[model samples]
Target: MPHVQPAAPAPAPPVAAVVVLAAGQGTRMRSSRPKVLHALGGRSMLGHVLAAAAPLGAGATVVVVGSGRDQVEQHLAQIAPTAVPVLQEEQLGSGHAAAVALAAVPDIEGAVLIVNGDSPLLTTRTLDALVAAHDAAGSVFTVLTAEVDDPTGLGRIVRDERGAPQAIIEERDATAEQRAIREVNAGVYVAAAGTLRRVLAGLATDNAQGEQYLTDALAPLVAAGAPTAAVVAEDPDDVLGCNDRRELAARRRTLNDRVLDELMRSGVTVVDPATTWVDVTVSVGPDAVLRPGTQLEGVTSIGAAAEVGPDTTLVDTEVGEGASVVRSHCLGAVIGPESTVGPFSYLRPGTRLAGDAKVGAFVEAKNVEVGEGSKVPHLSYVGDATIGRGANIGAATVFVNYDGVTKHRTTIGDHVRVGSDTMLVAPVTVGDGAYTAAGSVITSDVPPGAMAVARAPQRNVAGWVRRRRSGTPAAEAAAAAESRTAAPREDRSEPSRADSDS
Candidate 1:
C-alpha cells in the first residue's frame, strides 16, 4: 500500500462571541464622563477596544454597559452599529458581567472571548494567539497572563508543580507568597461557552469584595478535571488597562508612538515623532512628510508627496498629492494638488482650493472655492466667495459676506484682478478680465475688461492741517512745507527773447 499521510485536523471554528465588560464607575478617573469613553488618538477608549476586536470576525459582539449607559450606548451605536449593548444594571463583578453578556447571545456556542472595555492597548494579535492556544490544547478555559514588573493590585496566577496554571488568586485574598508572584492575570479569557455558562452560575460572592469574581471559575473547572490553560502575552503592555488620568496619558503616548513608528516603516516621514500626533483613523500615503507640531485627526488623509506642518492641524480634511500646508489650521476642507496654504491661515469648513492655488500668510477663508492658479495672498478674509482661474485677490482684501442678518456670496470671473485694500461687498460679481482699482469698495457688478473705482476723487484742502492743529508736530511740518512752497524761486527757466536781445 502506498504511504498515506493522515489529513491535518480541521481549524477551530471562529469565536462564537466577544463580550466586552464596561460596567465600572471608574471613580478614580474623577470625571463625570464614563472612563471607557475617555479618548486617546482621536477615538474613545471603548472605540479602540472595539476596533481591536473587530478583525476577529466573531459571530457577535456584546458590550455590557452600566454607568453612563446612555452616552456609552450612543457612542457604541456610532462606532460599532452591529455590536449589541447589554446593560449590566448593577455594579456586579466581572463574572456577572460576562454572564449578562452571554445571556444576550443565548444561542452562541463554541468559544467566547471576554475582554475589558478599558484595555484600549489590547491587540487583536494577542487575542488570536490565546484563542488558538485554547483550541490546540482543547482546554475548557484559558486565561491570558502577563509578567509585569509590579503586579501590585492585580490577581496573581498560581501554577502547579508542573508549571501549569492551577488557579488565580486576587490580591486581596492572596497569601503573602502568592502576592509576591509577578505573573498576573490580564482579565482576558477564552472559554467554552457551555462550560463558562455552567461555571458562572455557581460563582460565589464570598470574597473580600463580596462580588462574584471571574477568576473563581478556574478553580471549579480545574477541580472538575476539565482541562484549563494560560497564554502569556508577548508584550505585557498589550494588557495594560486605564484607571486614572495619569495612566491614560501614558497609554496615549505609547499608542501615538506605535502609530508613528508604523507610519515611518511604511514610507511616511515623521520629522519629530515626539511632537507629531496622528489619529488611527487618519491615512497618509507613502512619501508624505509630517513635520513637527503636526496633528492629523478625524478621518483626515494626506496624499503622496504632500508636506504638512511645522505647526499645522487638520481635521476631517483631505490634502491632495504634492500639496503643502504649513502653520495652518484646517477643518472639513480640501486642499487640491500642488496647492499651498499658510505660514498662518485658517481654512474653515467647505473651503476648497483647486490645483496650484495659494492662500498665503494671515489669510482666513470659509466656504470659499479658489479656482486653479488663483491666489488670495496675505492679509485677507474671504468667505462665501468663488474665485475664478488665474485671478489675483490683492493684499488686505475682504469679502464682506455677512451683513449681521444673512450671509451672501461674491463671484469673480476669469483672470480678474482685485486691487489692494479692496472690499468686495457680497452679492456682487466682477466680470471676466475686469479690474478693481486700489482702495475701492465694490458693491455693484463690473463689466468685462472695465475698472471699477468706487472711491471718491482726490481732493486737496490747502493749509488745512496747519489750521486744524497749530501747535502739533504735524502742523509744524505742514507750515514748513507751505513756507517753502510760497517762497519765490530763483529763475531756473531760460530768459525770454527780448531779454536775450538786450
Candidate 2:
C-alpha cells in the first residue's frame, strides 16, 4: 500500500472568525437603542456589518452586543441565524468587547477580523483585500490605516524610523511629533487568532478611564519582532464608527451612496441617488431608470428598461421589463412587461398584472389578476377581481366586490368593453366579448357578446324649463325640492308685483 501520509491532518479547515465590536452605548447616537441597532439604508447598521464578514467564509462569526442586548440579539437573530451571539454586559472598552466576543471563537489557527459594528460602509472586497495582503506578506496581524488631514480624535499610527511597526498611540498618549503624523488608525483589523488571544489576555487598564484597551497590545506585537504592518485604506469612512446622531446620518448617507454607486456602476440609471433609498438585497436590472425620490426596498426586483418615478415606492414588488411606474406606490405585487402604472396609483398587496396592462391614474387594485392588454383607465377600484385579455375598462369603473361583511369577486371576460362609471357587482361574471353601457349598475351575469344596460330610461318633457319660469316647471322643481313650504298657502293664479319683477 502507498503511504497515505496520515490523511494530511484533514486540511486544517481554514478557521476564521469575525469579532464585531458593538457593546458601546454610543452616547452620541442619543437613542435608547444601541448605535449598532440604528437603521441605515433600511436594515440595522450591525446587519450590514455582519453581512460584510459572514460572506467571507468565516467559520465562526461573533457579534458583541451590549447596552441594548435584547433588541440587538433580536435583530441579530434574523441577520445572522447561524453565527454565535455574545453578550458583553459590562460595556467595557472596544478591546474588552472583542475579548468577550472572542470567548465563543473556537481554538483555531486563522485570522480574526475585528471591525466596528456601526461601520455600514465596509465592503467585502476591501476586507478580502486586507486579508490577502496579510497572507501574502505572511504577517500575523494587519491593521487598516488611513492618512487623513485632521486626525483630530482618531488614534495615530506610530511607526519607528526604520518604517517597521512600532505602536498605535491614542491622541492623548501621542507625543506632539507623533500627533503630527497624518496616518490614523482605522478601527478595522485582521490578526492571527493566537496572537489576538494572547494580546487580549495581556491587556491592562492604565489609561485615564482605567479600562482594558486593545490599542495597548499593538506595541508588544511590534516589540516581539512579529511581522506587523498597516494596510492603508482608500476611503476613511470604511472604518468610521457612528458615535452621534449627525454622524449616524452621515454614515447612512455614505453607505446608501456606496450601494447606489455600485448599482450605477453595474448599469442602473439613477437620476438622483442622493434622494433614493435602496436596500442591500434589492436587485435592479440594467437600463432601469430610477428617478428622484424613488425608494426601492425589501427585496424588490426592477426589470430592465423600466422607468420608476420621481415619487414612487416599491416594496417587495417585482416589475417586469419595459414596465413604467410613475409616481406610484406598489407593494407586494408583480407587474408585467410593457405595463404602465399611474402617475398616481396604488397597487396594493397580492396584485398581478399580465403583459401590456395599463393601471391608470387614481386607480387602486388589490388581490386582482389583470390579463394582457387590459386597461383600468381612471378613478377605478378593482378589488378582488379578475379580468381577461383585451378588456377595455372606461373611466370611473369600479368593481364593487364587497358588501359590508363579506368580500366577493368580479370576473370580466376577454374583449369586453366596459363603459364609464359602471359598477360591476361581485360574485358575477361577464361572458366573453360582453359590453356594459355607461353609468350602468351591473348585478346579474351577461352572456357572451351581450350588452348590459341597467340605468333608468331618460324622460324628456318639452318646454319644461319655460313652464317652470311660468310656474309649471317651478311646480316640477317644487315636487323635487325637499322644502315645499306648502306653496306659501297663496293662490297660483294671482300674478301681482312679483310677476312684474319677473
Candidate 3:
C-alpha cells in the first residue's frame, strides 16, 4: 500500500491538462454570435468558463472550439490573459470533442480533467478536488458526478454491490431500471492517462444518436477492472450546462448571485441580492455596504467600510476605504479614502479623488483630480484639471479645460478658494491660497495669496425692474429683465421632474 501522509496543508497536485469541451453549434441559442461568445455581464460567455478552468495549475488547457473556433481563439487570447485554445472542427458528440482535445494536450503522464465550457459555475477548486480524488483512490478513471433529487434528463450512475465502482447510463440510452437511479453524470471528469487514451481510441459511433457516447466509455473502463468511481459535487447546479436562453439566464443569475454572496460573506453588507448584480472579478472590502439597485461590474473594487449604491452604477472603479459613493454613475475612476461622491454625480474615466475629497450633487468630473480635503461640492464640471489639497470650489464652478480643438489642464494650488460660477480657462493656474471671486471668468493665472476678480464693471440699472413692470418697451424689458434674473438663475435650486405626476 502507498504511504499516506497526515492532513497536508498544501493544495492538490497538478493535473496533466484540462480539456474544455466547448464545441457545439448551440442551435438553441439562436444567435449569429456563438453561444459561448454571448456576453454575461461585462464578459463573454467563454470568459466565465475559461475563468473556472484557470487556477487549476494544470500543465496545459485544451479548448475544443468548433462553431466559433476562430472567434473563440481570439476571445480566449484576449480575455483569458493566459490559457491555450485547441480546435474541434466537426460538430460531434462529447466523446469526439474529448478525442480532439486530447490531441491538443501533449504527452499526459498525469490525469486529464474534462470540463464543459457551459458549466461556468464549476470552480477551479472543484476541478482540483476531482483530480485529487481520482489519484487518491488509484482509480483508472473518475468522473465528477452529482446526485439529483429529481433526476430527469440526466445520466444515472450505476454502481456495483459495494458502491465501489460504476458505469454511467445517459437518460437517452438507459433502460427502465437505470432510469430509476438518482445519481447522474455531471459532465465533468478526471481520467487516468492509459485508461482515458485507450477509451478515446476505441470510441465507436454506435449509439442510437449515431454519435459516440462518452458515458459508454465508462463501461469499458469498468469491464477492464480499473477502479472507476463517481466524485459527486456538492451542488448539482454548478454542473448545469446552458443550451437555451432560459438556461443561460439562470446560469448567469446564479453566477452573479454567487459573486454577491461572496461579498456579503466577506463582511460586506448587501441590502438586496435580487436587484444587485456584480461581476465575477469584482471585490468589496469588509464592512462595505451596497444598497439596492447597485450594478457594479468589470474589475470594480470597493474599499473597507465604504457605502455605495441605492441606484449607483460603477464600472472598473477602485473606491478606497471609508469612501461613500451614492446614487452616482462612476466608471474607470478611483476615489481615495474618506471621499464622498454624489447624490447625482458623474465621475467618468480618469477621475481621481484624493483622501477626504467631496464631489457633491450634480457634479461631473473627468480626467480630473480633487486633492485631499478638497471640495467640489455642487453644480460643477471639473475636467482635465488638478485641484490641490484643502481647496474650496464653490457652486457652479467650471474648469474650462477644453477649447474647440484641444483639451487643456487647469492647476489649482492648495488652500485656493474658487467662488460661485467661476470659470477657470485651462493652461491656467490658480496659485496657492488664491481667492477667485464669484462670477469671474479667469483667463490668466493668479499669483499666490492674491485675490483675482475678472469681470466687467457693474452698471447700475436702478429703474430696471420698474421699467419692466411699468410698460417699458419689450426689447428693453427683455434686456433689463435678463440681467436682473441672471444672478438668481445662477443660484437656481434643483429642478423638479417634468414628467413626474403628483
Candidate 4:
C-alpha cells in the first residue's frame, strides 16, 4: 500500500492592518446621525465591523471619519479604544477615504484589509477566509466579490477571458456589457500596502461621479502586471450594506436571525425566532428558553434552565439558574437562582433578588434587595429598602422611601408580614416576626414580635346619607330601610275567631 502523505498545512494568514472606511455622508439615509452610527442588533454598525475585524489580530486599525466626526470619534473611543481615527476633511469618495486611513499608519507594510464600516453583517469567518485566500494566491490586490440576482446600483467586476478579475467598474462608468454582469464588488479588499499606496496616489476623478473611484485602481494594478484576484463570498448577505432605513431594517432582521439560529443550535430554545431578538453580546446558557417578544440586549446573560420572555426586555441584567422572568422590563438588575419576576414588573438599577425570591405582577423595585424566600407581590413600589428572608410584602404596599427632600431607607426583618394598603414610611423598621395592619401608615419602628397599627378608630354617623344626600339613590335606599325597621307587626287572634265562625 502506498503511504499517503498528509497535505501540507495551508500557510498561516499574514498579519495585516485593517482600514475601515466610514467617511460617507450617507445622505440617502436622511438622518442627522452618521450612517455607521445606526444600530443593528443592539450595536452600532461601526462597532460590529470593528468586532469582526478584531479577531484578525491586525497590526493596526484605522477608521476614516468625515461627517459627524465628533460623534463617530467619540463612539470609536468607547467601542474600540485602540483603533486610530483619522479625519477626512471632505467627502470626496471611498478612494479618498482609504488614502486618508493609510496615511495615519504610514509605517504599516504587508497585507492590509480595507472594509466598509456600514456592512454590519460581515462576520469574522468571512473576513478570515478572505485573508487566507489573498495569502494563498499571493495577490498584490484582491477584491471580495459576490454574485447577486440584481446588480443594480452596485459596482460590477470585469473579468477577463481567463476568468481573472481585470477591474471593478462603478455603475455610473460601466458600459452595457459590464452593467449586465451579476458579479459585483463587495467594497472589501486585501492589498499589499505598497501597491495600495501607489494606486491611491494616482486615483483620477474623470468618471461620471467626478470623485476618485477606488474601483479605478483595479484596472491599473492589473495592467501593471501585479497579480490580482477576486474571492467570491460564500454568503452574499455577508457583504450587504445599509444605505437607508429600509435596508437597515432588513440587515437587522438578517443579523438577528443569525444570532438566534446559533443559540438554538447550542441547546438554547427559541420559541419564536421571528419575534425574539438577541444581541450579539448576549449569552444564554444551555437548556434556557427564550419565548416570543424577548429582547435581550447589552451584555444580558441567562443561566441554565432559565426561562425568559413573552414580552420581556432585559438590558445589562443577569439571571441566575432556574430563574424565570416574564413580561417584565429589567435593567442593570440581578436575579438569583430559582427567583421569579414579572408579568408587569419593572426592576430598575441596583435591584437584587436572592434565591426563591419573587417580584410579582405590577411590582416596581429599585435600589432594593429582597432576601431569600422574600416576596414583593402585586401592586407594590419598593425602593431604597432591604427585606429580610421569608418576608411577605402584601398587595398595594409602598415603602415610602422619599421624603420632601432626601430619600431614606426602610428595613424589614425576617418573617415580617406587611398587610395590604400598608405604607411603611421611610426611616422606619419592622423587626423580626412583626406585622403591619392593613390600611396602616406606619411612621415608627415596631419591636420584635409586635404588631403596628396606625390608623384612626372607626366611628359611624347614622342616617347621614339620607340627611346630606337627599333625592340620591343611596339616600332613597337608606330611607326605605329605616321605614321597614319602624313599621309594627299585625295581630292574628281576631283572624282565628272569624275563621272558626265561618
Candidate 5:
C-alpha cells in the first residue's frame, strides 16, 4: 500500500473588519465633488483603497461619507457595491470618521482595520503584513508607521525611555522636541474590535483643533497594559496622503511611475517612462513599444510587437500584433494585425481596421469597418460605412452617412476604387471592381465591373474672351482690363477645384 501524507494545516480565517474613513470635506480640492471621488489612474481614489482591501478577505468594509455623501455613495455603489456607506453628519477628525464607519460594522470578535480613502498607493501586501505582524505579536493594537525625510503635518510617533513606541503626537500638538522625531504615524491601525469600540466611545474633542484625534487611543491602550506594536513600511511614499492639488499631482506621478515600471519589467519597452502614462486598468502585451507622450486609458490593450506613438491616446481600444499607431486618438476602436494608422487620425467608437489596412493622416472614422488590405490615405471622413478588401479610398472621399432625420451606411465591395473628392451618399453601394469617377456624387448603386460618373458633360467655347474684345479698340481695352482681373493665379499649391465649377 502507498503511504499517504497528512494534509497541511488549514489557513487561518479572516480576523479583521475594514473601516475606510472618507468623511472630511476636502476643501483644498476646491470642487463640489468629494475628494475621494476624484479619479486617479483611471478609477476614483476610494476605488484604489477598496481594490487594495479586497484581497484581505475581511469580514466587512464600511465607508464614512460627509459633505458629498450622495455623490460618493452613488459612485461607490457602482465600483464597490459590497462596501456599506454611513454618513458622518459633521466634519470631524480622522478618529471620528473611523468611529462612524465602525458603527456600521457588525459587533463581532475580530480586529478593526482603519484606513484612509485618500491613500491610493497603499498596497494589499502591506496591509497583509500588518495583520501578520499583529497576529505574531498577539498585540491588541498595531499601528502602521513610516520614517520619512519630511514628517511635516503628519503625526509623529512618541516613544518611551526604552525607545519603544508609546503613543502618536499630532503635528499641531507636538512640541519642538517632538517635531524632530522622524518616525510618523501612517494613520492606519488594526485594533481589537471590542477594545476599539470602547476607545472610540471615550474619545474627547480636546485638541488644539478641538477635534477627536484617533491617535489619542494609542496612549490609553498602552496604559491599560494591552500589548501595542508599530510596523514601519519600507517605502515612505506608500503611506503618503493627498491633501491638496500639489500633493494630488505628486501622487499621480508616483502611481504612473509604478505602472510604467511594471510594464517595462514585464517585457514591454517604454521609450520614456516619464511621459508615458498607463492607467491601472490598461494592459500591454510583451515586446510592445510605447513611445513618449502616450496615454493608455480605460481597458486599452496593445498586442505583441505593436508600436504606439510619440503622442497617442487610446481609451477602451485594442491594437493587434505588429500594428503601428502614430500620433492618433482612438477610443472604443479595434485595429487588426499589421495595420498602419495615423500620424494624425481619429478613430471613434465602433471603428475597425482589418489586417494590413491603412488609415493615414488627417482621417476621421466612426462606426466604419475597413476590410483587409484596403487603404484610406488622407484628409477624409469615413463614417457609418463598410469598405471591402483591396479597396483604394482616395485623399478626399466622404461617406455622407447622415440625413437631416437619420443616419445611414454606405457599402463598397472588393477591388472598388473611390476617386478623389468622391461622395457616396447614404443607402448606396458600389459593386466589386466598380469605380467612381473623380469628383462624382454617387447616389445609386453601380454593378460589378462598371464605372459611375455623375457629372454634366463639359462644354468649351473657343475664343470666348477674344469675341468679347472683337468690337473696337475701346472694347478691347475694357475686355483686357477684365481679363486681367479674372486671370488664373500663379500659385499651383492651392487645392484643386471641383468638376461643378464653371
Candidate 6:
C-alpha cells in the first residue's frame, strides 16, 4: 500500500471550440446584406449567436463568412473581437464551411461545437446541456436534434431500431419513410476534435445538390465504430433558423417576447409588454416601469424606480434612479436621478443632465452637460453647451454653436435667465445672475448680474400714422398751405354751432 501511489485526478478537459457557419448567400432574403447581418431585436443574427456562445468561454471561436466579409468583420471587431473570422470564398456547402473553420484551429484537442449563425434563439443552457450529454455518453459525435411536428425544410434524423441516431437525411434526399420521421436535425453538432477534421476531410460532394453536406459526416462517423448519439432539444422553437425576411421577423418577435418576459419577472413593471421592445443587451433595474411602445436598445441601462415612455426609444443611454422619460428619443446620453425628459425631445450623444433637470417638449440637446436644477423648457436647441445649476432656458432659445467655418460652445452660468426667442451666438457666455432680453441675439458675453439687449432702439414719427391713413399726403399738405395763407390775410372764423353739431 505504501509503494502504490494514488493516481492524480484526471486533468479537466480543455474547453470546446466553436465553429459558426455563416456564409450562405441567402438569396431568398432578397436583400444586398449578408443573411447573418440581418437584424432581430436590435441586433444582427450573428450578434445574437455570438452572445449565446460567449458563456462557453470556448478555447477558440471561428466565424466562417463569405458574401459580405468586410461588413461582418467590421461589426465583429466591435462586438466579438476575441472570435476569429475565416473566409470561405465560394458558396459551396456547410461541410466546406466547417472545413474552412476547422482549418484555423487544427490543433484543438477538445470537442468542436458547430452551430449555425442564423439560429439566434439558441440558449447557452441548452448548449451546455448538449455538451454534458455528449460527455456523459462518451460519444465521438453528437447531434443536436428536435422533435418537430412538421419537419419540412429541416433534415430528418434517421434512427436505428434501438432509437440511436444513425444519420441525417435532407428533405430533398429523404425517402417517404424518412420523411415521416418527426425528429429533425437542428444543424448543430459536437464532435471530438480529431474525428471532425478527419470526417470533414473525407466528406464528398456527391449529393443531389452537388455540394458537400455536413450531415454526410454523421453516417461515416457511425459506421466507423465511433460512438454517436443525438440530444433532443426540449423546445423545437429554440432551434429555429432564419433564411428570409419572414423568418427574420418571426424570430424577432420571439426574441422580443423573451426579453420582455425576463424584464417583467425581475421586478420591472411592464405596462404593455406586447408593444415594448427591450434588446437582449439592455438592463433595467428593479422597480422600473416600461410603458407601451418603449424600445430600449444597444446596452442601455435604466436605474431603479425609473419611468420610461408611453412611446420612447433609448439607445445606449444611462438613466438614473427615479427618472421619468416620456415620449423622448435619447441616444448615448446620461440622465440623472429625478430628471424629467420630454413629452417630445431628442437628446443626442454626449448629453448629460444632472438631477432635477427638465428637458421639455420639442427640445433637442446635443453634447451638452446640464447641471442640477436646470431646465430647457420647450422648443429649444441646446447643443455644444454647458448649463450651470438653477439655470432657466426659455422657450425658442437656441445655442447657435456652429458657424460656416467651425463649431463652438456656449456656456450658461448659475441662475442665468435665457429669455424666449433668444439666440446665444457661439463662443458666448452668460455669466451667473445675468439676464438676456427676450428676442435678443447675443453675440458677446454678459457679465455677472448684467442685462444684455441686442435690438434696434425705438423711433417715433409724429404724423406718420395719420398721413398713411389719409392716403393723399400731397393734397393734405396743399390744403394746409392755403389755410395758412388765408389766415394771415383775414380773420379765421370758427364753424357755426349747427355745422359743428352736424
TM-score per candidate, in order?
0.93, 0.86, 0.86, 0.93, 0.89, 0.88
lDDT of each: 0.94, 0.86, 0.85, 0.93, 0.90, 0.91
Predictions ranked by TM-score, top down?
A: 4, 1, 5, 6, 3, 2
List candidate 4 segments past 4 Å from native: 1-13, 484-502
| lDDT by residue (tens digit), candidate 1, 279-395 | 999999899999999999999999999999999999999999999999999999999999999989999999999999999999999999999999999999999999999999999
RMSD of each candidate?
Answer: 5.2, 6.9, 9.4, 5.5, 7.9, 6.6
Clashing pairs in 4: none
Model 6 regions more than 4 Å off: 1-14, 459-502
Q: What value does the lDDT take at residue 75 in candidate 6? A: 85
Per-residue lDDT tens digits for candidate 4, residues 1-502, read 9999999996544756899999888899999999999998889999999999999988899999989999999999999999999999988888998898888899898999999999999999999999899989999999999999999999999998999999888788789989999999999999999999999999998766678877888999889999999999999999999999999999999999999999999999999999999999999999999999999999999999999989999999999999999999999999999999989999999999999999999999999999999999899999999999999999999999998899999999999999999999999999999999999999999998998999999999998997899999999898999999998966765767667888
Model 1: CA > 4 A from native? 1-13, 487-502
Per-residue error for 351 in candidate 1, Å, reads 0.8
lDDT of 3 by residue, 83-200 (tens): 6676766666888888887876657667788887777677767776777788789887888888788899988898889886567877887899999988888888888766787898
Which pairs clash in model 1? Answer: none
Instruction: State the TM-score for model 3.
Output: 0.86
Query: Lowest summed lDDT over 10 consecutive residues: which window, candidate 1?
Result: 9-18
Error of 4 at 135 (Å): 0.8
* Candidate 3 worst ten-residue window by lDDT: 487-496
Show model 3 residue runs off by greater than 4 Å. 1-13, 39-44, 458-502
Candidate 2: lDDT over CA atoms?
0.86
Model 6 / residue 197 / CA error / Å: 1.8
User: Model 5 segments beyond 4 Å from truth?
Assistant: 1-15, 161-163, 461-502
Candidate 4 weakest ten by summed lDDT:
9-18
